[model samples]
Target: MVVYAPAVLFFLAFCVGVLRDRRRFSNAVFLGLAAVFALAAWLVELIREDEQLGRSVVVGLLVLATLGIVVLAGFLVSNGVTMIRKEGRSPANLLSLLGGVALVGLLALLVAAWVLHTHTLLVVAGTAVALAGYVGFLFLCFISYAFLYGRLHIRRRADYVVVLGSGLVGGSSVPPLLASRLERARAVHARLSVRGRQPVLLTSGGQGPDEDLPEAHAMADYLVERGFPAELVEREDRSASTEENLRFSKSIMEKANPDYRCVIVTNNYHVFRAAMTSRQVGVRGHVVGSATASYFWPSAMIREFVAIFLAYRRTNLGICLALLLGGALIWWMR
Candidate 1:
């Protein structure tokens, strides 16, 4: 019961933090810490209840869970590696490298502690520290995502509107996610038109393996069917990714009119990351988010947070490495 006290306190604090400021990253940190503490307490209680079960079932379960985590981490690392191979050195590639190295090191440490005779306290403390490092990494991801989202600055009026490509459902039809983006762009266009300002709509996307036609073509058709002027709509059918979507659309806009201010539309979950990508690609525009289904927001936001963190790999990696090393040293000395 005494051992569980810290977990209870942390949880109470986390709840308070969440209620106070839902938008702050500190809320996530507090909740994550509370969860870890609770899990640790539960594991301890389980071990105490049945020593044999602890040695066999509990240990096995923990090992399996660890392996699953490693596998997922490996997938991310491999994806990063593939991106590097195809696109050359980038911030995302650096994140993969750092994450891969840290994961490998952690696994090696775990194996050493299990196989060799080491001070049990030292091993336990080291594991806790490593867990904390993982939490810090997650927190960094959230902060980066928020930073990008907050920095986006859209003008009151624009001469053109661009709906960025997410992907296609069946090569011709827009998925619910992509449709949300298109609808948001349409709303913005309508608002501008109501104020006597006309803006051209640019739908941007390109053909992929499963896509029967370019995403831009499908988007343009959706607009026209909904009574958008066909003459005012342009299809940028050569962009394969977000970077290409912004860059190619900018080119088309420039050709049509040299001075064009536009807003890029995407899902709310993706607004921040897209804005950062826009800046990196030299696209002069702001980003606006469309509404998303309630159930999809959490996971989608987590994905975007991860993407933004990877965009600033060096700083995040440096912080994580420092914390991990410091924690390991403290545990060893103690």
Candidate 2:
């Protein structure tokens, strides 16, 4: 019971942070740490109550977890194959299969480290494993918090619905990915209308060298074809990236209403990162996610985490240097 106190405190802090600003990634990290500590506390209690029963429970849970990962890896590999067949052999489409193969390789590394009994290889493997575990923990936090955030309800009326754009297909056509964002923006628009408000639907993206027209224009045309009113639709066709999208869109919204609230729409795989971008640019709104292709999600998620890690590279790099120095000292001692 006493051990659970820290978990409770962390959860409370997380709740407070989220309530204050749901866009912050630190809040999610706290929530994840809280969950980890809470689970640990529960295991301790179980062990105290009955040692044998607790040990069995722990073993069963570990077995189930390991089996679950193996099954997931297999399914992802199969999905990756399907993605390649349907979407072509782009490296992105092959992500799931590569990830599955990587998992298998990791297991092999563990076996080899044990069997070879070589200190140098063991040290290298140990460092890799530790780094992987830490990254996995961070990803767990990100995904869990993103899932929670995506399900949040709109508590207030919005002045705008900003749909972030992806690349157009074949220079001029709207792809399914971009369509999903527009569809989500439409849904958000309907919700705002129901609340007796007509929020502007802003499509934000710039033209690429290969694109036939600005992405925002193509997105706007897509919405109109689907029967969305032209008058309520706005376009910010100069944003070449997510940060620029938010920055440019915020300027538009602010010009009309300085205190305007809005929702930023993107695919589910991008919701959290988009939220972080919104916060960085001082945008006022929560974010909502549309569905994404299942096969593309794992790879897209990895990319997002990498982007996030790099965004805070100074602190992360510092930590990595510290860990390396610590490992070197330990090795020297041995």
Candidate 3:
């Protein structure tokens, strides 16, 4: 209980920081500190305990932590190496370089400790610290989403509603998730229609390998079944990914109405990333989220964060490596 004081304090600080200014990167830093303190508290308890059961638990946790670090490090290395050797010194290459440097520095630290006759417990502790740093990074990725989502606002109405496609059921029917998005899009469309502003509905998705038809067609059909007019619906069936979906749909919208104001509709779990993709694809629009199931939110949010992290893989990896090096230096000094 005593070991948890710092963790509790850091957690409070994090909550306060977010409450004060939820959009800033500094909030992420505070949350990261809280995660580090929490991990440290757990590690300290493991170290202080004397019973066999306690020791076993500590060992198991340490092993799991080490494996997680190794796997993450491996992924960084492989991604970096691939970017360097094939893709050149783009952002991905930079990520690989930073990850490689961190791995080397960590390895050097271990060797130095080995040469200096440091206690085995100290080495284990260092590994735990490294793992904590990586976990903190993962925590930051999730925290960024919460921060972004909290700050987002639907500031204006639009002339068109674009519903981005998720997977289709049997490649011909709208799944519940996609249906929710279409429903939201329809509601928005209906609202605008009632105000004497009828917006075109763009259902965007292409055929994947498992699908028998394009996702856009399925979405269009679903919207029609829900009593949306067929003439008001447009299909973008050539897009194979989110980027393509937005880009292709934007092209379609631009051709019909060059000065188009649009809002993208996706599931609540996907709104942030979809907006980011919209920005990336040069779509001039905001995003609106439909409802998602409570049980699905955690995993779906995690997936969205990972997708965003990978989208800017180099910068994110560089930041993580910097944090890793800082943690390693602290471990060495101790």
Candidate 4:
């Protein structure tokens, strides 16, 4: 019972945070930690019951983990190729492909060091591997909790429906990705209408140098063309990035209705981060995501994660450095 206390307490804190507001990265981290400690507690109880069985289970888990990584690498490579053909040959599309190749290379290096029985090489590899593992763990935490966080439902009526913009298709058209978001916004608007709530549809984006017109104007036209009410649509065509999109939209929503509640719309891969950003910008909004193409999702998600990691680069770098140094010290001692 005492062993389970940490898990219970973390879970309790997570519940409190979520109940207070579900749009928190901390809440998801708390939930993930709770799950981790719960598993640790179960493993301890199992070990106490039977030492041999516990050891076997741990060994089996390591094997499974290796196999899982191999499988993931394969998937990433295949998906990356698909992105090249379907999405384009942009540098951004190569992230998954390069990541998969790097993983395979790392494994090969480890095998080479092991087969050669080189203590120095092994130590260096171990330190590098530890750092990679630390970053990978954070990535896992982000994606896993993002999956859980996206299950949030919009029970309360919204006064505004915000559709965040991606770049325009050419200079004057909505891209498939942006279209998906608008379609989802329309559905949300329909639901709010059914609840006797008339939420304003706000399209947020600014003109880019290559674009002929503002993205917000293009999105608003797309919605109207698709039978969304023109009267209910307002355009905030002054934002150049996600942060600007939310901040400027927040300004517009506040000006119109000082006590407004809103829901943001973006592609499925972008939802969690958008919600987090919305919260940061003091927007009272829960985000809902639209469908995204499978081939594009991994790279898009990786890009999002990189942005987040860089946003907290100091903290992330310090943790990775600590892990690397710790591994090196242990290796030196051995």
Best by TM-score: 4
lDDT of 3: 0.73
TM-score of candidate 1 relative to the true fold: 0.60
Residue range 1-334, candidate 1, lDDT tens digits: 8878887887787668545533334554566666677777877887899877766876787789788658956865675566566546766345555556566766677677767756764555475556656655475546554544445455767888999988887678888888889888988888778878889899999988899998899999988998888998989999988889998988998888787888889888777667667777767677889888754554455556676567667876777787667766766686
User: Which residue segments of model 3 deviate by more than 4 Å?
Assistant: 1-155, 323-334
For model 1, what is the error of residue 70's alpha carbon versus the real structure, in angstroms, after optimal superposition?
A: 22
Relative to the true structure, candidate 2 reaches a TM of 0.92
Rank candidates by lDDT, best first: 4, 2, 1, 3
Q: Clashing residue pairs in candidate 1, if any?
A: 171-212
Q: At residue 265, what lDDT does model 4 achieve?
A: 92
Clashing pairs in 2: none
- Give each model a TM-score: 0.60, 0.92, 0.61, 0.95
Q: Provide backbone clash counts, one per model.
A: 1, 0, 1, 0
CA RMSD of all predictions: 10.1, 2.0, 10.2, 1.6
For the record, the alpha-carbon RMSD of candidate 2 to the native fold, in angstroms, is 2.0
Model 1: residue 116 alpha-carbon error in angstroms: 18
Model 4 per-residue lDDT tens digits across residues 83-152: 8988788989998998898789878878888898787778877877887776787688789878877777
